[model samples]
Target: MKIRISWQGKEVEIESGSPGAVLVEAFGWKDPRPIAIRLGGELLDLHSPLNREGEVEPVFPEDPEALPVLRHTAAHVLAQAVKELFPEARLGIGPATEEGFYYDFEVPRPFTEEDLEAIEKKMKQIVKRCYPLRREELSKEEAERLFSERGETYKVELIREIPEDRVSVYRQGDFVDLCRGPHLPHTGMVKAFKLLSVAGAYWRGDERNPQLQRIYGTAFFDKEALKAYLERLEEAKRRDHRKLGRELELFSIEEEVGPGLILWHPKGAIVRKEIEDFWREEHLRRGYQLVYTPHIALRDLWKVSGHLDFYAENMFAPMEIDERAYQLKPMNCPFHILIYKSRKRSYREFPIRYCELGTVYRYERSGVLHGLLRVRGFTQDDAHIFCREDQLEEEIFRVLDLVVYFLSVFGFEEYQIYLSTRPEKYVGSEEIWEKAEGALAAALEKKGLSYEIDPGEGVFYGPKIDLKIRDVLGRFWQCSTIQVDFNIPERFDLSYIGPDNRPHRPIMIHRALLGSLERFFGVLIEHYAGAFPVWLAPVQAVVLTVADRHLPFAEEVQRELSRAGIRAELDARGERLGFKIREAQVKKIPYMVIIGDKEVEGRRLTVRTRKGENLELGLEEFCARVRREIAEKIVF
Candidate 1:
């Protein structure tokens, strides 16, 4: 028999056998880098046999689609090493993540640092052995029997869930795993890898299920790439918000209060206030009416908004109050909808925007909660716009512009925007969904912005435009979202008198410029490394005296700054000027006004910036310069 292989618009006839044969003849055998074959759009093992003609493409190491495959192979290698080290270890699921891979195991005890070291050593040995990975297809009954004999209860359970009678499994040396895989030819292909850390994870992310030990690891195509990744990881550790939150005395999460609830310190609260004041002023200037709502509302309100049915999992349990059930608000949409319904509106009032810094509560899993990013209670910079159908596109354009402005002001110049369409189980009609999606796309195009379509990732109620800001370290944070909702308006019976003098449904747009103040603050902390710009800094300037005699002079300078609306402080401690300067630096203060005998006598201020720039100027000159820098929100 003959088989034809077509690649890059070229075709060749070869004797029927494995695709690996053609690749070896065309390229070479056992190349060091990750190289695989994609047959008719399905990724396949290079050794996968081909008995018929098909279009083939080579997946190189640099291809974006190849990293998941490489990481998955590394996961298999990790499992093999674990089984070798501890023969009694049983496996759970191992999957590839965005950054790397992780494998769960049901071991006698949690893995220790020493155990990870041993497992990594054994993985290296397996790579040296270059054991070939072979795939096998077996009937469900046979697969269950195979795993049962090996005491792999997890594998047996997994097999039972497979609908198809035939299941695929991969084996290397004495290790076997139930998987539908397109792995590398052998273990040697994984050139550079590292075992990062281990943590306890409930099976399948359910709190009711038994917890398993999960080992996280990463792999790269070469050693230098791996080295670069490790260095970035180190820098990330140095910028970790949790560490800096404490070291800089910004915020804290205390067990006495509760998990996922942040206790903002004085300095942190000052920063938050600055952000809130700026946000409110900008919204007011842009035609938004600020409003306030209660933290808890009657449960029927949620039912009307569809949150009770669709979002109950993330909501707190209901509290019964005087024969009525009340729930902590998980969102501000319902209240805003109620506000619109309070009075009959007119088309002339179209594009009515209501914004609030509303605090909301949700029940987050304890294990998944971080310091401030994944908090249970957070204040959202929430807004909702009610507009006519014809105004939808223009309103979206305005929201996108506002989102970009807010992110840019916070020093986020690079971002990734995604337009998410309707999901499978959605509330609105298909016609409305298509219209909303088209409006979002049109707005993006009108603004000359490029965005990717995230199919089936939108909320059940609406389509949305999600903006992810890339910080200084090249990490992305989901901060801003603009969603077009038709369901809530219909559910709430929100209507406006149109030009025809008839009541028509007003489409609602839900927006959050900063998704949550706590999360955004955490991102800001890490993004700027706690060295906030002067406008956002809690203490913009600190006055320090060179000697006890200059205390009066330092106090006067600080008072003048405070009068000028700058957040200034006076460090009047009985320590040396260098010690005081170091303390101010540690606090990440933007400016330091040093007063020595010469400056005190001359009635001048010596200004030192956080970046170590110094300038000797008259008091008035220094204040003017500082005000300009703060007003401009300069980075450094």
Candidate 2:
């Protein structure tokens, strides 16, 4: 039968009995190399047999869909290489991730840097062989027997866990793995690959399971792309907030202070203050009323709100005070709900938007703690809106507008938006679900924003819209989330008397434009490579003395800049002027003002930017420029 393969604005017809065969033929063409094939919106391996006619699109390697495929194939290659090098190594699971791929193995010894190099060498050889990947099906019993005979206990265990009577496995040369695969035609397709590192991971991400050595690797379709990716990785490492935070004396996570808990130094606190000030100004301008809540609430409050039952695991262990259990808040929703229920409201006062930069605690797994990104205690820029059913769409539209405005101000213009509908086990009646989902959809449409609908991906209580902003390196971070909750209002028995003289439940919309302040700050640090915009920079300006004679002038200039609301500091560390300038550059300060005898005599200052450009200006002129840049939030 003839099958059509479409890719990169071109289509070709080939004779094949399976989709995989068609993909192999299409990939043979030089123009369509490094393509991802999908049949009727379902991704298929090049080895998958076609049972019916369907539309196919070949996604390029750079495409979002193709990244997973490339990384997955790289994982398979890594597994094959490990097996070839260590005959006794047993495979657990090898899956592709957002950054790359990792394969877990149960080996007698953990893999080291040398082992990674040797395995990489073996992988290159395997790729050169260009062995064809073939898929086969067998009965469950037969599959278990085959793997058991080969001493592959992990594979046999996995096969035993399969519920079906029959199972599929893929083979390349002598290496076989039980998988539901649409793999590449041959190993040689993985041309540019590198083994990144080795780490210990649980058998299936469960701490209770046996620890397995996981080898992480990444791959690309071509050498140039691989080089670019490596360069980006290096840049990201250099900009990592953990490193920058420590070197800049911003924050610290100490063993004595406990893990996943940040101790913000003066510098970090100053940055936080700036962020909070800006956030408050923007929220107020948007007509949001700010409120404060306690760090701990009675367990009964959470029980009534359904969090004690639903979110108990993530919550901190309860503490007993005055013979009653009180728990550190894991979320600000219930508190906000109680506040809404505190007083009688009316339809005329509908759409009450309340916001808070509330701090909460969670029991994060120890292994997953990474700087400020995943923390045990952090503040969320949380807000909740109580509105009538008729006002739901407008409230959501306003939140969407606020999200876009805030993200754009941070230089995140690109976004990936997802509108998630009800899950199968969700709360509320079907009618309520329909109304909530429709409101979210209407808001998106009203704003002229395109969003992907995620079927059955919502929380158990409500549907939601999640927004991911694209960073400079093309990585997306989930920042903004807006959820419509019909359950919370019902659980809390919240109502507002309408104009019709009837008490009606108000719709609750929960939103966090920046998600968690800590995680957002981490992303922001990496997004701008620690050289934040003028307004957001922790230290906007640094004043340096060219010599001892210029010390007084430098101090005066620093005071003036500080008075003008620029975060300025004076360098009096007895260091050379060149050294001070370099220190400012390393600290990522936007501006550096150098004071010298020439400038002091002329009652002027020498301005040096982070980019190393120097200009001579009067003290007043420099202060005015700095003030304007900060006020305007200029990128420079």
Candidate 3:
């Protein structure tokens, strides 16, 4: 049989499971292990017969595109293992994640560590059989019947949602699953895999849906690679922000307060204040005009903004006040638009930039509430720019520049940018959508920024550019977005008088450098492992007393540091120096200014850094160094 595949700018004839390389070789990775192959953006197993191939790229273990495929196959193996142990377990959607993969099942009870071990043993047995995965495509009606006969109601429900007449399912041995094409060649290919943990997840991520137990796991081509990944997982656990927040007395979510509502302790508040001060200063310097809006607005405002129609599910329920319905603010964009319409704008005021650190509320499900990362009430660094069509691209470029600058300030140098286009349900005309998308693309191109096109992932109102920053743990966190909208202006009848005194609709560009303060703060905690840089650290330095004899000196030193604009604290407790230093280390203080007898007599302070570097400097010199580092926003 002949296979039509593109290789080196020419068509080539090869059979299934053909040997391919050079994609990894080009990236300086010499991994020769083949897991799957990518043909025209779609992944296919090594043995899957190609009907029509454009270009096939072999996926190696070291390839960036291989983990999702491997982990997805591991999830199927996990499901098969679970089915062997509990034949009544009903399956849910199992999609691969950025880190690994997880599959949900409606089990009678949650799986335990013992269950995981038993499942792993069963998986090994299945792998030993070397079952070749067979893909079958049939009518959707037949697929529903097949799953319904097996009592897999969840699968039947999913099949009903598919708009296609035909659906595909994979079968390995006696196990069958409703899924799309492209998985590993056989069961034996799932070699090095481990079930990490189990958690409760709602089916379809909807709180109203049935609660299912999700089993999380990771897989790799080899054992050594799996070991390394497990090690990284351990590091990630150590850096978990929830644990650090409690241990450091930074923040908490109390039962008295609602879930996803953060109550910051003194230390956390200090850090937040510093972040706010810096943000305000930067925005003011960058030609931004700070504005404030009410916490609640009339329900009619949301209706006019289309939030009531398109975003009602996410918004909190409205309350009746003074015989009028009032809604809690979910977004600051509509208010900013109101501010624009407050005054009759002219061509001279084409680009009206309004910035605000606005606190907004949303009805987040309890099941999805995560520490500070996913919160119901959080402050967004939201800004809006109403500009003429000619100024749209340039304004977008400026926003991109600010986004990069803000992320870099927090030591995030790597980012994954995605340009999301129109979704299925959206406002605005096709011409306006195309123009808005074009402006964003032009700005990104002019800035020489590479991005992926996320099809049908934009908000209902507009196309947007989402910027996700990579933390130290190699995890990506969404922190910035730049969206362009023309429909909102039309909805509000926003117009600016042009050179000919004609009413021209002004294009609105919505931007947020730090998507939300709580989530960004959480990312920062994990990125630095709670050891903040001197600039952002709540306690920049702590004065440690060597003995009761050094109380006077320590007090004087801390006062001096505080007077010099450093956030310093004095630990004058009658405890051993080692104990005090250890406490300071636990708090992750950036500096430990130790005052002892010899140093007191010498009139010098022995400053030990968080990294354990000892520097003996005079009080004046130490203050100067701290000020320099703080002013320069030095990250270490």
Best by TM-score: 1
**Best-fitting candidate, measured by lDDT?**
1
The pairs that clash in candidate 1 are none
All candidates: TM-score: 0.96, 0.93, 0.93
**For residues 1-636, could you state the per-residue lDDT of candidate 2 as single tens digits?**
776666555666766555455564654644656444677888877677665555676656666787677777778889999999999998898888877889999999889889989999999999999987787889999999999988888888889889999998889899988888767778888889888889888876677888899888888878898899899999889989999889887889999989999999887787788788989999999889999999998888888888878888788899999999999999898988878888999899978999999999999877678998999999999999999888888999999999998888789889999999999898899998999999999999999999999999999989999999999989899999999988888888999998998998898999999998889988988888888888887888888887787888778888888888788888877888788888889988888887888888888877888887888888788888878887877753
Q: What lDDT does candidate 2 reach at residue 493?
A: 92
Q: List where candidate 1 sits over 4 angstroms from the true fold.
A: 1-4, 12-22, 26-34, 49-53
Candidate 2 collision pairs:
18-50, 19-50, 20-46, 45-182
Ordered from best to worst lDDT, the candidate numbers read: 1, 3, 2
Model 3 regions more than 4 Å off: 1-41, 46-63, 424-426, 429-432
Tens digits of per-residue lDDT for model 1 on 1-636? 887888777777777866554665664434643367777887877766676777877788888888888888899999999998998988999989988999999899999999999999999999998988887889999999999999999999999999998998999899999988878888888879999999998887777887889999999988998999899899888889999999988999999999999999999999999899989999999999999999999999999888877889999999999999999999998888888889889999878999999999999988799888999999999999999889999999999999888888899988899999999998878998999999999999998889999999999888999999999889999999999987888887888998899989989999998899999999999998899998889889999888788888888998899888888988888898888888888888988999988998899988998889898999888888879987887765
Residue 23's lDDT in candidate 3: 33
Model 3 C-alpha lDDT versus the unseen true structure: 0.88
* RMSD, every candidate, angstroms: 1.9, 3.1, 3.7
Better of 2 and 3 by lDDT: 3
